[model samples]
Structures are given as structure tokens and as C-alpha cells.
Target: MNYLLRLLTILFLTNLSASANVITLQSTQDSLAKYSIPELIGKAEVTKDSVYLNYLEKKDLSTEELANVLYMHGNILINEGIMDRSRQYFERLDSVAKILKDPFYQFVSKLSIGEVYYRQKNYPASKESFESAHPFVAQFPEGIQRALAKAEYVYFYYLNGQFERYSKELEGIKKELIDLGEQGKVGDEDLDYLEMSKATVSVYLTKAYLMNEDFSKAEEELKYSDKILKERFHNKITTTAVQQKLTKGEFYFFKKDFKMAIPYFQEVNKLGDSENFGDFQYVARVMASIAYFQLADYKQSLSFSEAAMNHPIPIADYIDYEVEAMRYAYLASKELGLSDKAMQYSQKFLEQDEALKDTKRSNFINSILNNMEVSQLENDLIAKTKSNYVLRYSLIGLAILIVILVLFTVYQIRENKHNKEKIREFMHNLEESDKAEKAKQEERRISKANAEINSDTPAQPDDKTVKILDKLEEFESSDLYTDSKMSLSYLASYLGTNTITLSKIINTYKEMNFNDYINGLRIRFIIEKIKNEPKFEQYKISYLAEVSGFSSHSIFSKAFKKSTGVTPSQFLDFLKEDTR
Candidate 1:
């Protein structure tokens, strides 16, 4: 048994003694239960699963019989979208199956644990489970059990991004499933499960091909997948049918045909009793949101992304889906001019993304361990040799580094002094030029106003343009633009115009796009304040950034440089020099 599974067995053994109806570990009762776990799982009566579990718990079961109960419980928990509890049952099943030496349960239990991990965004652990189950692949009898296990193993390759390894495993399982069907090896009892397995494999294969950007191959896989579903399901909207629909939507989604992708995804959203659901509903809603976003339909995109966020499971349980959904929700909200909601979604996105990165970091460490673990002695030897090489090079590199640093520091100090002298002179000239520029601007404003009065017309501007320009002058004179939460839509709405019109007017008269125009105004305002207020010189750039509508120090520095050809630090340096 795997160490994790062994640990799970020890953990759950106390549960067996909790019920009065518990069977002794040494009991010699018949191992087979009246209801088959696999069959019950296929029925997927999620609502009535508690009744089934209650009935099973009351029975006197043997060692292998207990495995069946565990498997059923695991399947139920998984269907209910409770991954952590489902994982415990799977681990227990794997432990019991190992003791009984049952190939089918052993394989399925390990793979089920893997599926839980995959859904939990622990792909590295999922990969380990798949690999650990590999030796049991051929041990299963060539029927529904074997086909399902092999199909799962093959699907993991696609999940783990090992598409190059996918073709061989996929082809092998497809042939096995085909042979089982052609030879009539599958019994009526196993037919439905077998069909579903075949359909699942085909659908995901199509997804893999589409993900690979192999549209021709993807279409070929789709044809095969559709044929299987049409023949086996006949529009029944089974799980496999739902998966096939999602695959088709993904095909068009990846092809950049957002319009064509919409109906397929919408159908999936309404498929069966779709209960705010599992991976299927989550994926469908997320992809539909992305498709709508691609088509610039912000309202529809926000609707779908919001629906995905409202999935039955907590957002943390499905980090990948949460990240994507939160990201798009934020973007859609932003595009629709909902700043408050956008900021909330943005914070959620960051939280989910950080969690995702943490999982990735663990996987990265695991990859390193796998690559280095030839043997303990070899690892020790390699570490010693690597450290020795590092130390030997470090001293020489440190000397050279120190010498370069000293020289660079000296050069920088002198360069700084020279730059300060140049900037001091430039600032002196700049102050004179500012007075001249202000006079010129005032003269132009007076000239234009007087010209308009004399001619009884504004210069080249229509009445509406003139009104907007006047409102803009009033807007500029106020500190309302200093709000860092400002956006084009907000400004447009404030101006009592649409974004398109506001943008065009800004671009035409201001000779800049909306953001640049706002930023330009902010930079100019802050510069005048910094020049006039002696206390502002004592403040930090970060504070200045926040007060001036730039979100951060770096952004403020860049904008100040772009507008004035001098960084905030350089300007401050010249100011302090002038003050002294």
C-alpha cells in the first residue's frame, strides 16, 4: 500500500468501531454486497446517496465488503463536490484493496484519489497517483473495469500537460474499449459504464487536440466523439453528453469563434438538472464568460463569471477555476464601469492567484526532488560537489563584484553631482519658462474668448464642444481628478456623456487618449503644488503618487518623467539645491 493510503487506513479504523452494527475485522462473512458499488456509482442518485449509505452501514461486512462501502462513500462524496472527505474514503479503499489484493479496487481507488487531487489543483500529487496505479493497469479483467481504469490513466496525461505521451496511451485505451465492444466481452451490466468511459475518453481527447491548436486533428476527434455519443446516448444529456458539448464549445472557443461557442456553452449551462455544479458547470460558465469577454459583451461576461463564482464549493477548493472566474469577473466589471465590484473581484483574483502560485511552488519542489533522487549517497555526493564548486567560484566572483561595485558607486556619485548642477540650471530656466508659458496661455485664452465675442462664435468649436470644453476647464480647476479610482467611464458619466464621445473629444482637443490626458493633468497639477508648497518637499514619492491619482511610486515616477523630462527624485534634488 502507498504510505498515504496506509496512513488513511489507520486514521479511519476508529470509524468502523463507532457503529453498533460494525462487523468484526476477523469476521468470515460473504465479501460481496447485495448492491454493487460500481453500479451504484454509475446510477449517480446523488440525492438518495445518503439512504444508500445508511443501508450499507447497517450491514455486517467482511474485509473486502468494507472496501465496497468505502468506495461507495468515496464516490458519493466526490459527486457531492466534497473533495477532502471523498479523498479519505478513497485512501481507505486503496488500503483495503491492497490487503485483499483486488486489482480493480486497487486501481480505481488510487485513480479516484488522483481525481480528487486534480480537482483540488494538486496536479503533482495527482500525477503521482496516476503513476502509482500504472502497474495495476493490465491486472484488471478486459471489460468495463479495465477500460475505465485505462481511460482514466490516459486522461491524466492530458491533465498533466504531457500531450506528447497522450497519443500512445489514448490509442491503446481506445483500441481496448473497441475490442471489448466488438468481441461482445462486455456484459449488459457493464454496458452503460463502458459506453460512458468511451465517450469520456473521446471527448477529452478532442479537448486535448483543440488545446494543442491542432484544429484538423481536433475536428477529427470531435467527429469520432460525436458519433460515439450519438450512437450510445442519442441526445440523452448524460454526463458524457455534457462533456461532449463542452468539448465542442472549447473547439470554437479556441478557434476564436466566440459567437459560435455561445450556444453550445449555454446548452451545457442548462444541461440536465445542472445544480450550480461540479467541474462541468464550473468549466462551462467560466469558458462562456471568457467567450463573451472576447466578443466584448461585458454584461454577458460578468453574468457568467459571477455564476461560476457562486459554485456550490468554496472558491479555495477549486483554486484554478476561482482564479480564472475572478479574473474575468474583475475585467468584465471594470469594462462595464462597476469600479467597486471590480475592485472586490480584483482582490479575490489576487488571493486565488497567490494560492495557485503556492501550489505551483510545491509542484516545482517535487519536480526537483524527483530529478535529484537517484540514491541517498549520490545525492549527498552531488550536493557536496556542487557546494564546493559554488564556494570556490564565490570568492573570486565576490572580489570582482566588490571591485566593480566600488567603481560603479564612485562613478554614480560624480555623475549625480554633475547631473544636479545641470538640473539646478535647468530648473532656474524652467521657472522662467513657466512664467512665460503661463502668460502665453493666458493671452491665448483671452484672445480666443475675445475673438469669439467679437465674431459671435467660438473658434472652430460647435456649441456642444464649447460647453464640454467649459465643463472640462471647471473639472481641471477642481481636485476631483486626484481620486486614484478614476476611470474613463467615470469621467464620461460625470461629464454627462458616453465613453465614446468623451474619448473622441479628449483625443481631438487634448491631443491625447483618455488615460494619458487624465495622467497629464494629474502630473501638471502635482508639479504646481510641489513647486508652491515648501512642506511637500519633505514628503515621500509614494505619498505624492497617491495624492496625484497615480496608484504607486513607480507609476508616478514614470509619469513625472514623461511629462517633465525629469524624475521626481531629480526634480526634488534640484528643488532642495535651489532652496539652499
Candidate 2:
């Protein structure tokens, strides 16, 4: 009877351990079904806790169960946008995953932690976390977790603005996700979501491409996004109106179609419930103000700016808005000849500048990390030496080193503080110089490219205008335009001509405004680079624009498309066909 009872007890314990591992998977699924599904992200905690409690009541769980629970809890925290707390849970999960001998779980936990930091805009920490997890992912066998990790790796590369890597990873992940969808035989909704995920990745890639001055490719990607969204699941996700509107608004804002951007912001404000409001309303209002400002509607801009300042929103977004709003307020007041109001806003702007005193504090703190690490190593050496050492002189040497180290650290801290002051002063001067240079560049470019008509009859042309025009044409022909940042003022200065003369020559002779003249030169330059240069064939169209002086790929593509009546890619294809 005793032997039979012991056998049954051992069997029961074995079953319990096996059950804990698989049972938590079901618990996670159920919690995610009710909480994360339908995008009820706000109720995640309540639903998650209830599921965990039910699971706990039914079975005695092991260490693996604890780890999985913590991981799930971290997921819930992430959905709530509580990154710091989510990181702590993931760290705990990391330890548990190591003990459970599951490298795959550890990789996922670290990947999630990296994602949280990424969302917080803590790029350094995010990069460290992702890179650290890469080795673990390599060790782990292929599965859903590995696929997700690859997707996340693609995300990190995209965020860091590594366009080439982002492109390759995006293509790789698309094939993998498609294969996974087929293997699982997942239904249309799941496949739709996976495709949407790919579209979102493509959007970020396009953003990087745009920044890199590859506008033709960026437009192509945007069209791809449009195609994906137009399919069965565009706004079909059962998310809240506020959240949906916020995303759509950002999409248009990035595209720089501020006219289309405004309605989405307004929709978010109109439909969003008050109790759930936090940063979204404030952001929408501020963005709407910017859109209005861009359109030169000063009244609406001032109204939106004033409303945003008064909104009881969080401070993270306000640091940027407050500074901008003060400028707007001052400008509008000056326009109305309200000197007192203008003076008040100017004072507020000065105060805003004073508030950013700690901008260099993080850099100083980061510089101390290596010193701290060395100190830690020295302390460990001393502790181990304490048990073995017998020499009084050895002890004295350590004490002397420690005292010297302390003094050196104090001196370095003081020096760093002094240097910070100098750095700030240098930065202030640099900013002023940058502003002056920008003004000069803009003036020169406008003068050369735009036809200036005074309300009175146009002033007589300068006597040296013909010579200046010759110099301008010569400058346009030179390789200097390949600098991309080469401007009319720069060329005028180089040629010893005034910007006005250069401008008059460009407008009169070329019949083009400053931007158009330069852009036309740039486009022609890019065309030559693509056709004559073999090395540049691999270069994206946007890159060609950057090398030739367009600010963004979208602008480059639009201008190119207008000129050729074909997209840059199509133009490239045409070039290739002609060459063949």
C-alpha cells in the first residue's frame, strides 16, 4: 500500500510540472483574446490578472510558469505604454528563462525589452538590448519566437535609419511571414494583419528612404502602403476612433500633405472620449496648429497654439511646442502692433531657453560609466586581495591609489562642469551663425530663381549683370553643384557677384525661380550620374537627389515626375531599356 501511494505521488508531481508549462500558454491566449484583442488595451491589467488568478487556483506552477506569467504581465504593461515597469518584468523574465534553460524565451524577453526602449526613444539602450539578444536568437532553434525576433531586428534597423539593412530585412521578413501564414493555414484576418505589419514596416523604411533623399522609392513604398490598406483590412481593425485617427493623421503628416493631415487631427479630437485622454489630444492640437501655420493662416495657428498651451496635457510633447508657441505668439503680437504682448512672449521665450540647462547632463553621466566599471573591478580585486595579502605596503599602495582616484574624479567633475559651460556658449554662437548663414543662402537662392517685381516698375539692371550671368552659368556647369547643398549665394560669393545680380540673371536668362533653377540643374546632374556613371547605378534615385541638392526624396520625386511625366523608377527603367 505504501509503495503504491509513493508511485502515485511521484506520477502526480510529474504531471503537474508538464501541465504548468502548457497550461500557461492557454492562460496567455485567453488573456490576450479578451484584453489585447479588439484593441481594448486599456483593460489589459484587469483581464490579465483575472486570467492569472484562475490559472493559479487550478494548478501549482513551477519556475517556468512564473517566468511566462511575468512575460505576459510585461506585454500588458507595454500595451498600456508603461515602458519602465515593462522593462523590469522582462528583466525578471530573463533570469527565469535562463534558469529554465530556454534560450528562445530569453531572446523574446530581451527583444520585447528592446522594443519598449525603442518606443521610448531611448535609442542607445534599445540598440544595446537588441544587439545583446542577437547572439541568443542565433543559439535558439527556428520557431514562432525566432520569426518574431527577426521581425523585431528589422524594426530596430528601420528605426535607426539604416535604409539598406532595413530594406533587406523587410524583404526577408515578408517572405518568412508569408511562408509562416501558409504553414499555419491561418485565416484571412491573420494574413491581413501580417500584411499590415509588413506595410507598417514599409512605411518606416520609406521614411528612412525619404530622409536619405530617395523620393521615387519612398513614393513607391507609400503606394504599396495605400494598396495594402485599400484591401479588406484598411481601417477594419476594431480599434478605438482616437487611436485610429492618431495613426492616420501621422501618416498624412509624414507625407507633408498638411491639408489632408488636419481632418484626421480634428476627427481624433471630436471622437475621443475625455476620460481616456492624455497625450493624444494635445499632440493633435499642436500638430493642427503647425498645419495651419504652414498654410499661412495665422489666426487659426494662434488659436490652436493658445489652446494647446492651456491644455492640461503631459509635459513631454510640450518642450517642443512651448518654445514654438512662444515664437508664434510673439510674431502674431508684433504683426498686430501689440508691443506689450510681444514683449511678454519674448520674455517667455528667454525663460524657455533657460529651462534646458540639463541637456548635457546625460552626456557627462555617460562619460562616468567606464570609470565606474574600472572602479568596480578595482574594488573586486581589493576584496579578493584582502583575504590573501599580508603586506602592509601593499595595503598602503591600494589606499594611496584610492585617495588619488577620488581627487582625480573630483577634479574631472569640476573640469567637466566648466567645459559644459563653454560647450553651451559654443553651441549658442554656432546656432546664431547657422541662422545667419541660412538667411544668406535663402536670400541668394530667392534672388537668383524668383522674378522680383516691385509694385513700381522694375529697377534698371546692373551694368556688370552680363559678366555675373557668365559666372553663374560657369558655376552651374562646375562639379560644385554635386555637393547637393551648393546654393546660389555660395556660387555668387565664389564668383564675386552680389546675390541680386545672380538672381536677376537666373530669372531673366533661365526663366526659372531659384529653387527650380537649382533643382533643374540637380535633376540634370542626377540624370548624367545615372547614365554616364556605372558606380551610381546601384544608388537609389533619392540618393541621386541628395547628391544633387533636394531636401527629401518625396520632393525630388514630385519634381522629377513633373518634369519627365514618369516616376523616377520608370525613368530608370526607360534609361535601362534605351541602353539595352
Assess each prediction's global lDDT (C-alpha) against the native.
0.67, 0.56
Ten residues in sequence with the least summed lDDT for candidate 2: 1-10
Kindly list the per-residue Cα lDDT of model 1 for residues 216-270, writing each as its tens digit: 9888878887887788768564556777787788789777777998999898888
The lDDT of model 1 is: 0.67
Best by TM-score: 1
State every prediction's TM-score relative to the real structure.
0.55, 0.44
Model 1: how far residue 371 lies from native, Å: 35
Clashes of each: 0, 7
Give per-residue CA lDDT, model 2, range 3-37, as digits (tens).
11111212222321333323322445654434322
Q: Compare the candidates by lDDT and give the number of the best one.
A: 1
Candidate 2 wrong stretches, greater than 4 Å: 1-69, 72-83, 101-105, 115-123, 138-147, 178-193, 213-216, 219-230, 238-251, 268-286, 297-580
